[model samples]
Target: MATPHTIAVAGKGGVGKTTTCGMIIDYLCSKKTGPVLVVDADANSNLNEVLGVEVETSLGAIREEMAQAELKGTIPSGMTKADYADFKFSSAIVEEDEFDLLVMGRTQGKGCYCYVNGVLKSQVDKYAKNYSYIVMDNEAGLEHVARGTLPHVDTMLLISDCSRRGVQAAARIAEMIGEMELKPGKMGIIINRAPNGELDSGVKAEIGKHGLELLGVLPQDEAVYRCDCDGEPSSKLPQSNPVKQALKGIMQELGL
Candidate 1:
């Protein structure tokens, strides 16, 4: 089995992580470098929208069903718990021409996030080996890492907006990753939604304070904003789109 190289994107909410994930997938697909397994690990899932797809099911929903069934002692007659889980997990993936997407939707009325996260980890551990690349779009903060949702990350791209708080959030996440010993092969920071793709000195100082490698900055592109307004898939952004081009350059810089 080929070991899949996993790229997990983390950032504060509204920091453009989902759009960046979509662009990464698009670039990979354009280069014929799939099949990638795209994981929307955010509770408030929106990667499907960015990628121009609809999620009919999610791992959270599946986990909820399994929990209910287990309570009722219902294992679908002949199937064992493990087998049934594997079956349901297969259905949760949305197959696309370039890659497959798995969404980790909200765990409703949560008793604890432990169970669902474990299930997601199990599925990713099992399914990821079949792919050459696995790109995970994580929820805000470090909960996913703490839960072991992503067993390993080849590249951890910490994204932040132009705000000081956003950079602080990324720095905190990086600290968490280190403190938890979830060391990825490479880790870097991306400043998204930068004004004219330029960073202010204060922002640079904050980044320096955390010693985060500046992967690159994504310009505030009107095309991306327009697509969001008109409900267009960001993955369909034109090849000349500045945001897309900048992300491609960043990916190249990482030797992806």
Candidate 2:
């Protein structure tokens, strides 16, 4: 089977990265470029909240359980430890009509996470080919990508919130990706929640200095905030919402 076109979204917190990731998934599914796999690789996973989906389990939660079981030497009869772990991992994938979400629930603590991350990478590698698009909403930084725990990325979209610090944070992520030599097919910076889906000269200059391409700007829309406040799905935003429209343009520019 052919591999899916993977798009990984990364940025500092509070930059609207998760919301934009949701928008990318929504846009792709709307275009019938599914079945899309949405990986909430963020430790503080809230992608489901934005998508209005429920998750019963997460990779981290089950990893802890399996590891503890192994420590206690309680691998069930007739089932290898690997098989039991795989079963739990499969259950972590929450199915939805338009997409499937696999969340990396909590932050890693002390001790090596190699075994769990290894299983995650193995499972992702195994199942990724079934989808046409895999959109990963990563954590605030480049930890997962830098560790090389996830599947290969086709494109990486770095998001900023039209602030100088936010842009610099995105630039740092881009720099880290370069230093690590992950070499995604396409990499670009997106200015999110901008005043009018437009960037001023100063922000453009800052982005240029980092050698990052400005794919497009997403305008601020109060409707998005209202939805968040009301605990509603971002995908439920009206077609006329500026943020939604801007994201559509951005996706088009990226040729997604």
Best by TM-score: 1
Off by over 4 Å in 1: none
What value of lDDT does candidate 1 attain over all alpha carbons? 0.89
- For all candidates, what are the clash counts? 0, 0
Candidate 2 minimal-lDDT segment of 10 residues: 107-116
lDDT of 1 by residue, 227-256 (tens): 899999988989899999999999999998
**In candidate 2, how many clashes are counted?**
0
Q: lDDT per residue, candidate 2, 1-256, as tens digits?
A: 8889999988998899899988888888889956999998887789999899988888888888887888998878899987898888899999888998888776257756566666667878888988999999888876777788867898899999898888899999988888875789999999988886678778888998888899889888888888899999987677677888888987887788
Could you tell me the C-alpha RMSD of candidate 1 in Å?
Answer: 1.3
In Å, residue 179's CA in model 2 sits off its true spot by 0.9
**Where does candidate 2 clash, by residue pair?**
none
Local distance difference test, each candidate: 0.89, 0.85
